[model samples]
Structures are given as C-alpha cells and as structure tokens.
Target: MTKVRTINNYTGIDTRSAIGTVDHPLANMDHAPTISELCKVFLKDGVALAVNASRKALHEAQLSPLDITHVVSTTCTNSANPGFDHFVCKELGITQPVEKVLLHGIGCSGGLASLRTAANLALGSSFRKRRARALVIALEISSLLVRSELDSINDSQDTRIGVTLFSDCASAAILCNGFGGVEAEPVYELLGWDNRVIADTEHDLGFDVDPLGWKVVLSPRVPKLTSAAVSPTFNKLLQSLPKLPPHYKTASDFDWALHPGGATILSGVEKAMNITPEHMRASYDTYINHGNSSSATIFSVMDRLRQKDMDKLAPDGKAKDFVVGCAFGPGIVIEMCMLKRNMSHIQRTLVVESGEATPSHTESERSEGEAGQEIEIQIEMGSMEGKDEELGEKLRDMHPEVPQQGDSLSEALNGVELD
Candidate 1:
C-alpha cells in the first residue's frame, strides 16, 4: 500500500471520479463482476452521462437534437451491441435518421480522433454542398474496471500504473460546416490536423479486453516515446497550416490543449516542444482535478482553457489566439490539431456595450443600465454553476448504490499524497 501511494503521488492527480466508489456493490465483491454485470452498469450510467453531456453541448451551441446530422462517439471502456451512442441519441430525442460512427480500440487519443473524424464528415458534407452539424462524444467509465485491474495486479504481482491514473468522464462537442450558411458563432476554428504512429512501439501502450473487463497495457517508456514524437508530429501539422499568424512560428508561440496522460507525459512534452508550464496550464489543472478520464479528458482540458479565469494564467498574462491540441493513444499514435481562437463574438459584444458604431449595429441596442445588469447576471450565473459537481450528482442519482466522492483504490492507498 505504501509503495502504491508513492507511485500514485508521481501521477500528480489529487482526485478523480469513479463509478464503483467505496460503497458500491462491485467494490464490496470478493471477485470482479461478470461481463454481463459490467455491461448493465455501463448501459445505465454511461449512457446517461453521455446524454447529459450531449444535451449540454447542444444547448450551448444553440442547436436542437434534430440539428445533429452525424454522431461520432468513442470509448475505451464499453463495447456493447448498438454502442452507447445509440442510447445517447435515443435519450436526447434525436429521433431523426442520423449517421453514427463509434470508434473502439482507441485509448487516450480517442477524443481528438473523434474530433478529426467529425471534421472530415463535416468537410465531406460541405463538398457535397450540404449543411452538416456533427456531434462528437467521448465517454469513459474507467472507475468500474478498478476491481478487475486490482485482481490482475494481485495475480501477477506486477505493477499496473493505470489503476491510479484513469477515471470517469463524458464530453461532447458540436462541429459544423462553414458552407451551412448558418450564422454560427464558433469558439475555435479547426485549421489543420495530423495523426502519426511511432515506429517499433506497438506494444508500448494498449487497451486489451479480458474476461473480467479491459486491461490497460501501459509501458513505462510511454512518456519518453510520446515526447520523442511530438516535435515531428507538430511540425507536420504546422506545415499543413502555413497560413497561421506570423507570430506563431513554433510550439511555444501558441497555447496548448494537450491530453494529460500523466505528470511525466506532460513534463516530457513540455521539454520536447520547448514550451513552458503556462502553455499547458489547463492540461495540468484538469489532470490534477479530474485525473485522466481516458477519451473524455481532452475535451475537459479544452473547456478549462476557454474559461475566463484561464486568461489570467496565460503566458505573459495574455492568451494566444492559436492553440495546439495533441494526444497519444494505444498504438503510440499521436493526434495533433491546430485551432484558431474566435474572439469575434466577444469583440462584437464589447463593441456594442461601449456604444460604438459597428457594421452590424450602428447604435447601441441596450441601454448602459441594461448592459450592466446583464453582465452582473452572467457573473452571478458563472459563480453559482459547477458543471463537474452537477454531473457527479446526476451520476450518483442514477446509481445510488455507488458513492460518488470516495474512491476505493484511494482508500486502500490511505497515505497517497494529494495536492
């Protein structure tokens, strides 16, 4: 137990969410749950979480369920017939005939891979002169597999660092084609993307299925191998997007939204890319607060980077307009993308508030008093709302038997260091 705690401290994760908490029936069992039992829990809690995340994304995008033309989902934790996306669509009232793609066998990079797939789908629709709004979802219920992993560790008497790294999360995003002709305000523009696999490292990282559940095959060399691949992968991405701002020449020039595979992974990538911790502030913050939630973690980091508070933590106290998104998966696959921040919406709002003449509005639409009142309302809303807490509550409600806060594994490693 002491050794495990020491190793877990190196992960730099303070806390993480899991499905089978300290009080869950599965946690109390003497052996791992059957495959059928795992499937039941996944269908219930996993699908519910996916639906909730998708609804939040659709709401924020101001799009209706019917507006989603395609669904691209990924998960390393569940492999049931019909997949969880099917139930997510049904629950969200998206009854329209929509194309759906579910990606499997992909580990941590699944989120970015799903986004790449959705981007291609959106581009295809544009080429056909058709409108498309693709919904991308990544959900992982890794906490449920704790018992199985523990059993394996005990049987082999070998360390499996993954047991201390993974958690549970569901994230969703809406991608639209520019040819849609809809007046949509996008937060980030996907300029370019690249995917590459490092040579001779096929066995270094993997997620293999077992009779009990899925087993994470993580080699200690993962951080070093992934770091070595970053420079070349990023160069290729930048080469493909030559139209980027002149000031953004290298990795350090732009902000980063990297998948927090682990503390070492983040630190290695930072060194390889010649960037600073401030460049990946959101990634560190997400990893420490939520741990690595498999395919769903990248979106959580992206969401954190866009928050107003993150601006203060940006390099030189000013956030960059461009961002680099990177993640690594089982095949030692590196998924990278270039994103340009869209601040037109915020700029336009500021212009209107200052009573300045703009192309869209010659006069102020709202009085100064009304504008101030609206700002106050938004501030109050932001302060009162906690997205993670709300989602945790919903999951706990769906599975009342599982305690949401305390993790059984963490309890076992009673002396684990937490930030």
Candidate 2:
C-alpha cells in the first residue's frame, strides 16, 4: 500500500521538505494521468503529509499514543475510500473508538473551518480528559496535479504561475480543554471564530473535476473583489463578538493570519484592513518561501509567527496580543478566528469558558537564542513605496540567507558560502 518510493526534500523550506513529493507522470507525454495515477498521488500526498504533521504535533504536545479522541482533516486535492483519517489513525496508532471527520471541497478556507469545529466540539472543559481531545489537520497537494494536458499553453509563464501560488503542505494542531503546562509554549487559545459565504460570487473561486484532473476555477477579478468585500465581512465578524476588547475598534488591533493565497490576495487584504508588512509579515513570508499552501498555509504562518510580540498569562488570565486568522475558498467563503496570546493554558482555559480569554499561540520554547534568530524585520507602516522587486530586494538584503524568487534548489544553495 506504500506508494512513495522515497523522500527528497527539494523545496528550500525545511518544514515543507518533510512532506513527500509527487510527479506529473503525463507532463512529457502530453496526456492526462490515468485516473488511478491521480488517485494514487492524492492519497500519497494527503496521507503522508498528514501523518508527518500529526506526529510533530503529538511530539510537541507530548501526548501518549492512542490518546487522541477525534481527528478532523480537510483536503481538496485527492480523495478515496477508507479516506485520510483512516490512514492517519493507523499510521499514528490512535486507539479505536476515536471519532473521525473529513472535510472535502472546502478549499483554502477549510483549515480554520476545521479548527472552529474542533473548538466547538471541545468546548465546556478547562481540563483534559483521557478521551477528550481533537487533532485538526489540513492537506493541500494541488501542486502535484499540474499537467500541460489541461492548459491551452503548456508550460507558459501564466499557466505555470499557479504553481508559484499553490503548493503542497500539511499542518496540524492539538485542541484540548486545557493543557497542564502554562509555560509549555505554542498552544493557541481559541478565542473567537467567524465564517461567511459571499453572495453572488460562488463561481468566482472553486475546484472543478475535469478530464486531466481537478481544474482550478480562479478568476482574475479575485483580488479587487476580495479587497472591496472582505473588510465588511470582517467587520461583521467583529460585530458578532460576544464582548469586544478595550479600544479594539478596527482590524488594525489584531494581527492578521491571512491565507497568503497570492501576493495580490495578501496585499489586497492588507490594504483593505489598513495594515502593513509588519502586521502580515508571516503571510508575506509564507507566500515568498512556501507559495500558497492552501489551507495548510496558515499553520505554517502561525508557526513561523509563534513568538512575535507574544507573552504568557497575566495574573488576571488574559493575553496582551490578539490575532484574527482567516482564509478564503470557493464558496467565496471566509473562514476566520479571533486568537489572543495566553498567559497560562489552564488559566486561559477557564477564561475561555467565561468568554474572557484573550490569547495567541505562543510555542513553549526559549524566546531568545535560536528562536529569536528568525525574527521578522520591523519596518514602519507605509514605508513600502517602492516597486515589487524593490520591496523583495529589501527583504532579501535583510536576510541574505533567504533564497531569491528564481532560486532553484541548487541555485538557492549556491549562495550558501560555507565557513
């Protein structure tokens, strides 16, 4: 049943390299991959990435084997019977009697959607029971399906542009009522959740089944449309908040966890919210380094951003920083969450029940040393008046180790002059 022959982490990003790779068998043949091949790629990419991510989360949470009570997964790439959850359970060795839910066709918005579901299911408890935990994971392997058979201009710049925006990645999180460690970092408190499907724009974005494989139904009007509409939707979410934090009147108050769907998408959301690179640095970095990894992209974004302006619980059981996580998908849907930095896991857990926990995901690790090395550059807002290349160049000079846009695996490494 093992479809993967090997693992070669060709992509520059180390985290994504852990996931397996796929090949377009028909690229050179100028034909479609047999449906069997497509299915095989889908299963392999989804299952492998899911298992790797789950294992990482388990290790980080220090969870014992067979301890997870439920597994929630989302994917729009490929699917089959016995599904990804079944594979994850067997591979991760979760005990029987575990609940399973698979969300399909949700597209990029599915990650936060799955997180919202997990949080709702795990509500009402501030302490973990042996059987009361949920693991949420998202896999988007759309990069594996690029075949010239489907595009009118094979390997053309525009056709290949999608690969630069969509990538293959998987990310997971362990949601419990509470964790024992207040100092154990990287636990994201589920503060608030919101979602909306934009009316009359259903066809604007979607995935459609086609002969070659899944056809991407993306419209060029996406950036402008989303820019104009998303802010209102975000405002609606804030209005639905049970209780607003002090002086938190606009989107500027919360750091954004945008999907990094594309450069335009990221910039569009940034412009609409009146935020800047510092506010959405993770989103920009994810796009430049990881491409748009669909639903899994935000997990990477949050992970990279774990320690930025974060802190532990105050004596009063609230956090200083807050974040709003969001993703857009085919239904023209917007998946959103309001997260705050937690001072203590158990303390915040109690506050969550009382609707007063404000927190962010602060990974329990030394904030200094290696963790601080990857910190983002702090630039003043509206300082980005240069062209795209100029901005990219400035970012590159700040971190010369970061590979440039046209960097191939070898080229990216070529600049790594050894000591």
Candidate 3:
C-alpha cells in the first residue's frame, strides 16, 4: 500500500510595518529611495517575518528545530546574503542544517511554484526513514518597494496600480512524510503540476533591480493577456487530472483563492475563467485588507477557508468540492491547487501543533433559513487587528467537525438547539 502525505501544519506572519506604506512614517516621503535603501528595509522586514513565521510554525506543529531538515524560503520582493533562510534559522535557534532554496525573481505565482517544488522534495526525496520534514515559507513585503505619489516624476496612472494593490504578509506551510502525530485532512494528492509561458507577455511584468532596489515593471495590458490565457491553461490543467467533476464549468468553475494581483487582474481572471464575481470575494478581501503580500497571498485565502470550515461544521455535515487556489509568477505563469471538502474526516478546530489552543469547536445549532438566503457566511474576523482570539473562538464554536459542517449544504442535516 502506498503511504499518504499531508501538510502537518501552517503558520503565518504579516510584515508590513518595516516598510513605507500609507500608514508608515515614510509614507509621506517625497521620493522613492535608492535601491540600496529599499534593500535595507526589505531585508530587515523579510528576516523578521521569516523568523517569526518559522517559530510559529514549529511551535504550532509542536516540532523541535531539529525536526525540520529542509527549508524552502520564497520571496519575490527581497533577497540577501545570510539570506532569509539562514537568518530565520539563526533567529529561531534552529540548529538543524537547513538546506536553503530562495524563490525570488518570480512574481506572485512563485508561492505556488515553491509549494510544487517543496511537495516534490517531500514526496520524492529519501527522507521517509529519517522522518525529514520540509518547511516552505512565502514572504513578501510589497509595501516596502511601493513608489510614492510625491515621487512620481513622469509615471502614468496605471504604473501605480501594482503598488496600490499589493500588501505585505508571510505564510508558512509544511509538507511532512510522517511526523509522529500530526492531524490533518486527507492527503490531497498532488495532481499534475505544469507551467506555460505566455509568449510576448514578458514585457507585461517584472522587476528592474539595481542600486535603487526593485523597480516594478507592471503593464496595463496584464489583465487582458491574463484573461486570454486563463481559459486554455486551465483547460490543460483539468485534462491532466485523472478525475474531474462532470459539473465543472471551466478553470473558473469554483470558489477561488487567487493572488490579489490587483482588482484588475482579479477582474480579468474571473472573466477569462467565466467565474462569477462573487466567487472571488475572498481574493478581493485579501487585496483590500492585506494588499499584495506576494507568494503568501494565497495562504491568506487558505487560512480563511480553513477557519470557515472549522467554524461551520454541521452536526451532520455534507461534502465540499468548491475551493481552488491559483497565483501568477514569473514567465507570467499561473500556479494552481484544488481543494475538495470531505465531511467524514476528523480534524482539530484551532489548536495548532504548537499546542496553542487558539480555539476548539463544539456542536451548535441555528434555525433553518428561508429560501435564497445563504446561511453559511465566511467572515474574515481577524483580518483586522485586536480580534484574533475572538475570531478563532467564533470559528471553533460553530464548526467542530467536517461532517457536521458539511450539513450546511442540506436542510435535512439540522438538529434543534436554542440560542
């Protein structure tokens, strides 16, 4: 029998403070700083974020420093000597000789690309006996490099959209062969991973790095080109999957966890994929609140889904086949992952492997609603500050198990309980 693999745990950090944003002290600065200055801010924020997220992941997963054998550090916004990987290990007191992989140069999609690479390493590497684990972190401090309005010399309005749409954040995901006792959902086997280059679109997006830091090169045409390519590329991905639902519409068929590349890109993708605008509210929420945290943006969406699922488990649940994630990287590539919700699976509510009981779920009941009303509402409770604990508790109280949460799909799955 083939062994199964699952993500043991996930942890994240938002590092927007060390940079200049609308709220940062330097936000009102007159000119874009030199590349070196950009580097300084980026490195500082990146290192701090990497360290924090690493600690959180290990703590939540309840894994010691030595438990991690490989480290994959991903960032498109920053790089340095004793790079993020080294800095993170050092800061976290992780003595394990972490093999490093820096995923820079690629744009937003790089996060998923890193995920694919890390997954391959976990599945194919000879680490099973050693119980070696791979930790992948996607960190982006986009706001740091954003151009200032006062500094705008001869730039077009479209040029600023990139900076406006991006926010800062870091997300850590782990792929373990078999950690002694890590509880997670079923092994969502890695289907086929593929990539394609949109010829002539290279001019659409990239960075010009020098002494002045990364000067973003974003084209207004990005949305149009992306919209054109989505249909074909998504179709190719579906054909590669061994099993696809008959009800599948197109690549844009389900609820999406997309990189908040910007409102424009999101609009383009929805049109290209033929998905309803409402299907992408999660992505929009991330954009509005977090901006564009590069590779880590998708995780924000995943975190939302995880929280929602945990908060809404029905006493008698149904299945979920409604979520998918995608991002855009270098070569203007799109990285995609599909999630299928299974109700029978048993999963913990909010306690991470780090053993911090953020929240725990119990059974709860609500009255059946009238027709045309969507009872299941996934709110980003903690996206704002000072509400993490309360939001977590809310999730646990409502969704305790997969089966019960799944019951939201059917009227017959309800039980009686008064408020």
Candidate 4:
C-alpha cells in the first residue's frame, strides 16, 4: 500500500540576534522552565525557536490540536523529563499522543534518522485502526555545548573551529497519513530509505558529558570523511532505482537540503558532489545567521526557500525533481532522503503573504545591546508577529536576575541552574 506523506514543516531560531544578548551568557538562554539549567545557552534559544516553528505549522496549515495524532520530537542538545514534545502538546493544547525521542550523543544527522523513524511508523501503522499523524521537531543548541575554555575556542588553531562555527536553532515538521483539509494531493512520497554508518569513526565526532554540559569534540577530518562517502552512496542509491533522470548531474543538480555542518563541510560537499553555489547558499546562510541548530538547521533553510518565493522565482511551471536532504551525526553516518517538489498553487502560496511587502524588524530597539560590542546572532525570525518587548518580558520574567541589555545572551544564562 502507498504510505502517507510529510505534508508541512516549520522552523524556528533563538539567538542573541533574535533575543537580546547579555554579557552574562545565561540571558539569551531558552526560557522554557522544564530543562536542566546547566545546558548551553544555545539549547534554550534553539527550543524557543522550535516552539515558534511548531506554532507556525499549526497556524499556517490551519491544523487544530485534535487533528494531530502523534508528536515525535528529536533533539541531541538537552532533554528534560517533561520534554518539549509534551510542552508542544500542552502549549498547542494538543491532547494527542506525544513521543519524545532524544537522539542524544548521536550528533547532527539524527534529524533524518528521526524523520525516517516517523515515516516508517506512518507507513507501518494501520490507518484504519487509528488516525495516524506525526510531527517531528529537531532542535539543536550547539551554542550550549561550545566550550569557551577549551583549546578549540581559546586557541586560534583548528580546535576553535567547533565553538565559532556552531550556532543555535530549532525546527518542527508535521507528517501525517492525510492532508487534513487541503486537497488530498500528497507532497513527497515515501521512497525507500538508505542509511550507512561508517565503521570505527566513533571517536571522530562524539560529545563529552561533563559538569558543564555536552561538549562537542568534532574531528577536523570530518569534511574529508563526508566528501569521501557522499558520491559512492549517492551513486549506489541511483543504481537501486530502475531509471535515472538525465537532469541529475551531481548532488547539486537537485535541490540540496543538507545540514549546515559548517562552511568548510559545505565546501567539501560542494566539491565532492558538484553542488552549485545556489544550492549551497541556503545551508551556508543558515549557518551564518543561526549557526547549527542540529536537525532544525535544514528546515530553516527550507523555510528560507519557502520565504524566498520559489514559485515567483520559477513561474514557468518548471518544477524541480528529486530534492535531496542530508544530515550527519556521531557514527560518521549520512542520512539522506529524496523527494519531488510539489509546486502546486496551494502549496506554493500556502505560506506566502498576499502583499509583496518586504518584511521588517523594528529598528527602534537597536539600543538594547551594550556599548561598543556588536551582537553577532542571527535574527532570522522573518517578519515580527509580535513585539520584541513581549518576548523580552517573557524572557526577563523567566530569568529575572539577568538584565535585558548586556554583551550577549550566554552571559545572562550563566547563572541559571539546570539541575
């Protein structure tokens, strides 16, 4: 039998740029009260960003809480007993079944792993037995794991690459057996999945669970490893297919939705798979603005594509085929999915605003940061749905001791107790 589809997705980001940064470090932390306080500042930010994303999906798709059947949450950053999966159910007023999966110590690629799991569940389960719907949320707080004291950040060598390159983010995606209210035309069919774990690379990229939090020890050889495996795996995937599309030249030929592992990782993949500049820009820009929010990073890029008005950009009805998404993790494994783009008017304009107005962030709040220190966080929340002060109040009330204006959000979050 044909399986259900992943219909809609939403992304979110929380960083100094979006939320006011403070010198204390803890100020910019995620405001949700359930998680450990020892978490890296970025984790909280990432979750907040992800929350907005889930909200956006519910609002934009006009999906009611009762319509949702399952909630699958993915994260490698932080996990509390009553995790965000439950928070999502509670906050969204979704009384449906919620399953929270912490892909802890797994690394960045876990998002795809979770997606595959969700897809399989939807495919395997009996839709007739019960309404089958699943929502997957991937939130990465890489910022929380950065060790400023580590030689990587302290030393100017390749070690510092990890701390400086990683940012914080969160993303929420909804997958269901039916499209609910919208026309029944499915977006992406559930094609077969192919995943491979490179052997003996466990030490290459893993986390150190210490008193501070999850510290990433990513090997410099990561990009090379990624470059080495991508082509063969891709070719092997193509071989399995009965007929290959002539349009497929390289990994870049299709729309690339790869995890923004880092700028260098992207460059390596670009060289390895012949990815074009346009294809890589989304990943790179997401990393630059929001850093790496783990699973959420890819969705952020997708959301940007959605926001860029791809339809207006390609109005000739020349739809793209075989969109590929890849994510990497601890096993030095690559998880990839191939899907076809659905450029139907409803899908295209579903999230697009009626007016062609350029979205704006209120510039009047620029003075919120400290003197002489420029904030480097990405405020990729797109157009403001509510006032920054409203979010600021929520944050301040969550952490009353932290001053609103400071060097960075991390500094403010320094004092919060995760235990």
Candidate 5:
C-alpha cells in the first residue's frame, strides 16, 4: 500500500495566452471560437498540452513511454469520439496493450476520482502482474464555455462570477505501485479514498449544453448547501481510517489539496471540516493565479505544494504529515483521498527504531464502539434532465475495457505483490 507513488506531475500551459488575461485567469470568450470551433481547438490544443505534460513528467522521473502500462484521463469540458486518451497513448508511442479509462460528466471531483480509479487499477491483479504504471490527466477549457449571453438573472450572475475564476488548464501525473519510485525524494502514497453525493444538488454545478455550447451553473446557495453536506461526510471519512481513533484530532499534519471551486467554496470546506485557512493556501493560490480550471485545478495546487518542499510531510516525532485531496462537483459530489508521504531516510530510521511498520495514530484516543456516528448530509441537487445532449452524445457511460488488476486493502493487501 505504501509503494503506490506519484513519481512526477506536470501542468499544461494555455496556448491561448489571451484566455487568462490580467483580471481573470480565463478571459471572456466573447470573441472566442464557436462550439464546433472550440471543440476542435480545445481537443487539438488540449491533447498536445497533455502529451507534452506527460513527456515532461516521464522525463523528470527518468522514465520512458515503455514504462507506462495504462492511461487514465478525466474531463468535463468536451467529450470526443475516439477520446483524447488515444492521442495521449499514441503520442507517447505506447504500442503495448495499455488499459484506458476516460471519465466524463463529473466535474471538479473528476481529478481525484481519476487518481482513485487508477489506484484501484494499480492494485488489481490483472494490471499488477509485473509492474503498474499509470498516467492520469485532467483538462478543462472553460474559455470555450464562457458566454456573453444570459437567459436569466441567475445565468448572468453565474457567468459573471464564473468568468472571474474559471480558466483553461491541463495536468498529468504518473503513478506506479511498488517499483514506482527510485529517487530518494519524498513520495506521496495513496492511503485511502472516499466519496459522497450530497442529495439534490445536481444544479449546483454543471454545464448547460445546447447546440451552441455549454454554460456553467453557479448557484448562489452553493456555500450553505456544500458546507452542510461536506461537514459530516468529511468527519465520516476521517473516522473510517484504520489506525486513526474515532473522533480524535489534535495538531493537523495533513497537506490539503481542496479543490478551489470558488473562494466561498474554500471557506465552506474550512468551516465544514474545521481546517483553518492556512491548510488551503495552495487552493487559494491556484484560484488567484489559474482560476478554477475545473478538474485540473487540484494538480496546479499540488504543484505549489511540491514547490514549497514536500519534505515537511515526513515524520517528525509525533508530528504526522499527510496529504489530503478533496474536490466537489456536479451531482453535489465530494471526492477525497488521504495520502502519506514515503518515509525519508530519517523517518525510516525512526520507524525501525520504534519497531512499527507504519506511523502510529497514538496522538489521541476515542471509544471503540461509540454507538452510531452517522450524520446525514443534505443539499439541493437536481440533475439536468434535458441537457443530455452533452454527456449523452457519443460518449455514454463506458466502463474500463479491462479486468481488475488488484484488490482493495480490505480484500487483499498488495503489500507483497507491490514490493
């Protein structure tokens, strides 16, 4: 479980420098391409960006295209026919029969969802035979969705607020299990992941697709609804960890990559999760500089974390350092994951001295069986029924065209297989 590693990560640059101008990360698309034009430009440019980003990641990790066994990508911007995933594989010159998963519909949460799905693939037996290496990509072209027209005061407000923070972005990460990392730098291992759907919030966020293009929906009540739903779910996830004591929190060592859906959304998550603003500096910085490029935003934030030096996540006595990723999207979905950094030489020495295989969660304690800690999360959600033209188009729900690679930790630990 500890071997799963983020070998390298990269973010795409907007070819259309005019997109993110002085004020907004994504300038108004009033003079931008039409739906058909945007689709063509976006896919072409997005694919190139993704491929180059992947190349950069592989280069930095000193890996080759032959090292990658699978390709996974997620996006809500535009759904293509062959899917740009094929392009990624083709560009990387990966001729082997690599597994591929291209997810759509899910918005901001799709990044973490993609990583989680890749983690499952890495852990599964089918893909774990020799080694597991997967590339995860997220791209968003909000400028294409930017609109000057509005149908209602709601639409006007949404576009106005949306344009202020939305941008064009693409990010790629290489994840491998066991033999993933050879460098001594700190490693981010996927520990666990959980997701929750806030009932009745479909309209809170989504793309209103038509023959013209897509329009973003930004409900004003998002903060209240999101906070109410996220509070308990966040708590529920913490309590689900194995070694973690139920209802125990002291000094926080978790490096959070909370999706910056917006400024208010950040505050809402903090209020709901009881994490201070300091924990979300990465998210805020991304928002201010890159805007909410949908699913790709989290990676930019993680890049900031990496730049600031991730060694802090290494163990320091009882001060545990962790990486937590969170994102919310259409369907009122909340995706989250907890990742622990690979032990540095010092940390390995300390753990060996303590005779523990993993970090201990002895900072706090709670009752073993404290009745039921269930807390219902409520929010206004509504699926866009008629807007099916977007997702329901050529790419419907298509599961990965491969068998399971490995099992979850509960089913069978990949410890031996990975090592």
Candidate 6:
C-alpha cells in the first residue's frame, strides 16, 4: 500500500474515477472480478457515460440527434458486438440511417485517429456535394482493470506503474462539412495533421488482453522514445500547412494540447520541444485532476485549454491563437495536428472594421466562407449523467492545486535519455 501511494504520488494524479465507489461490488471481493462481471459493469456505466458525452456535444453544437449523419467511436476498453456507439445513438434518439465506424487497436492516439477519419469522411461528403455532420466519440473505462492489474503486480512482483495511472472518461466532438447550410461555431480550424511510427520500438508499449480484463505494458524507455519523435513529426505537420508567419517555426510559439500519458512523458516532450510548462498547462492540469483516461484524455486537455480560467493562467495572461495537438499510442505511434483558433464572428468583424490585416485562414475556412463549404469542429468533454452523477459531483468538489516545479516528478525523470 505504501509503495502504491508513493508511485501514485510520483505520477502527480490527485484523483481518478471508476464504476463504483461506496457500493462497489468488487470492493470486498477476495479475487479480481471475472470478465463477465467487468463486461456487465461496462455495459451499464460505460454506455451511460458515452451517452452523456454525446448528448452534451449535440447540445453544444445546437443540433438534434438526427443531425448526425455519421458516428465514429473509439475505445480501448470495451469490445461489444454492436459496439457502444450503436447504443449511444439509440439512447440519444438518433434513429436515422447514419454510417457508423468503430475504431480499435489505436490506443491513446485513437482520439486524433478518429478525428482524422471523420475529416476524411466529411471531405468525401463535400466532394459528393452532400451535407455531412460526423460525430466523433472516444470512451474508456480503465478503472475496472485496477483489480486485475493489482493481482498481476502481487503475483509477479513486477513494478507495473500503469495501475496507478489510468482512469475513466468519454469525450465527443462534432465535425460538419461545409456543404451544409447550417451555421456552426468552430473552436479550432483543422489546418494539417501527421501520423508516424518510430522504428523498432514495438515492444516499448502496449495493452494486451487478459482473462480478468486487460493489462498495460509500459517500458521505462517510453518517455525517451516518444519525446524523440516529436520534433520531426511536428516539423512535418508544419510543412503540410500553407505559408505562415516566421514566428510559428518553433514548438513554443503555439499552444499545445498534448495527452498526459504520465509525468515523465509530459516532461520529456517539454524538454525535447524546448517548450515551457505554461505551453502545456492544460495537459498537466488534466493529468493532475483526471489522470490518463486512454483515448479520451486528449479531448479533456483540449477542452481545458479553451476555458476562461486557462487564459488567465497563460504566460501573457491570454491564450495563443495557434495550437498544436499531439498524442502517443501503442505502436510508438505519434499523432500530430496543427490547429488555428477560429476567430469568432465579432472578432473578425472588429478586425475588418479596424482596417487591420486579417489573420490567415485555412483552406477549410475559406471554403466555408466563400465557396459555401463549412467544416466546423467542436470537441466536448462528457458531463456527469445518470448513475455517474455521484462520481462527477465528487470530482467537482475536489480542488486541483498545481504543484510547484521543484515538487514535480519531472525532476526525477529529467535525466532519462534515449538509447
């Protein structure tokens, strides 16, 4: 117990959520729950969480259930026959004949992978001259695997720190093609993206299936390996975009929405990119508050970056307009995307009225404005709903205090170097 607490403290995660707390069925059990039991809990609580997230996203986009023409969902947790997205669609009263895509085996990068897939689908719809509104969802119920992981740790006496790092979450986003007549507000313009796998590092990270549930396989070298790949991938992503201001050449110039895989991973990336902690304020905040919720963590970080309080927390007391989104997964795969904040209508009008040079817009933006093609992306974190309200309320009640730099686990792992 002492060792577990110490390692968890090292990870800097204050709290995380599972299916149940006070009335947890497996709390008093002598052994880890069977796969059957875990599935039952996922079906009940997991589905509800995904539904809650989807509802919130739909409400925020000001669209009805029927407005969604395609559904793209990803998960490293559940493997049902019809998939959770089907149930989510049913619960949200989306009975239309919508195309559905369920992505598996993408791991933590699944969120961005799903977004990339949705963007392609939206583009295809645009080419076909049809309106398309694709809903992308990423959900994970990692907490249930805790007992199984503990059992592995106890039996093998292996220092598996993964048990202390994962939690549960569901996040959703709405992406609409410019062909539609609908006027939607976009938080970020999808400018360009890049995905690549580092060579000879397959054994470094994975999540394998187990009878009890699944087991996380993390190598100590992961932080070093993942960090080393960031620079090249980020450069490739930047090159894919149209000509931009010279100041955007480096990583620190833009804001970041990086998946907080762990304390070391975050620090390693910061060091490799030569970015300040303030550049990834939301990533660290999400890790400290929610831990790593697999594929869902990236969206949480992105959502946090948009909050008013986050602006006050920025280095200059205002958030940057250009942002970078990055995440890593099992294959040592790195996903990177360039995003520019969509100027609100009022902001655009003010710039025009003041006779100031307007900021550069992506091709998608110009299409939406001039060619009547609008591709709007809106990402949302799931809200507490149904039985999960108890967990949500508890989370809200807790205050998240950012620790000082000297108190961070990063210092301990700062010397980790790649082979």
Best by TM-score: 6
Question: What 10-residue stretch in candidate 5 is worst by lDDT?
Answer: 374-383
Which regions of candidate 4 deviate over 4 angstroms? 1-35, 39-47, 98-100, 126-130, 144-158, 179-190, 240-246, 249-252, 309-319, 345-419
Against the reference, the lDDT scores of all candidates come to 0.72, 0.57, 0.53, 0.51, 0.56, 0.73
Predicted candidate 4 versus true structure: per-residue lDDT over 234-339, tens digit per residue? 7776666545477775665676667776544665677888754355444544654465666666667655543333322221323255567777777778887665
Clash count in backbone of candidate 4: 32
lDDT (Cα, tens digit) per residue for candidate 6, span 332-357: 88988877765352111112224221
Model 3, 1-419: lDDT tens digits are 00000000000112223344466644545666665666677667766666555555554344556666677777776667666677777766667566668777777877777767776665554333333356777777766555542244245422233333456677775555443333233323234455677887676677656454565665545666666776676667777765767776555455666776655566667667766444665555455446567777776665554443322332123223556667776566767765553334332223344632232222112222222211111111123334334433432342223232233222111211000
lDDT of 1 by residue, 1-419 (tens): 34454566655677887765668897569899877888899899888777767766665555677777899999988899899999999988788899899999888899999999988887777667666778899999888787887887788765566778888888888877754343346667777899998888778788888888887765656777888999999888888877777888988899999998877677788889998777887787787778988889888887777766667667777888888999999887999988777644331121122432112212112111111100000000011124434333332332112222345443323222111
Query: In model 6, what is the error at residue 378, expressed in angstroms?
Result: 1.0
Which portions of model 5 show Cα errors greater than 4 Å? 1-32, 126-130, 147-160, 179-186, 244-253, 309-320, 342-419
> What residue runs in model 6 are displaced by over 4 Å at the alpha carbon?
343-374, 382-419
Sort every candidate by lDDT, greatest first: 6, 1, 2, 5, 3, 4
Best by lDDT: 6
Please give the distance, in angstroms, between residue 309's alpha carbon in candidate 2 and its true position after superposition: 10
Instruction: Tell me the spans in candidate 3 whose CA falls farther than 4 Å from its real position.
Output: 1-31, 126-132, 147-150, 154-159, 179-190, 244-253, 309-319, 341-419
RMSD of each: 11.0, 12.9, 15.6, 15.8, 18.6, 9.2
For model 3, what is the C-alpha lDDT against the true structure? 0.53
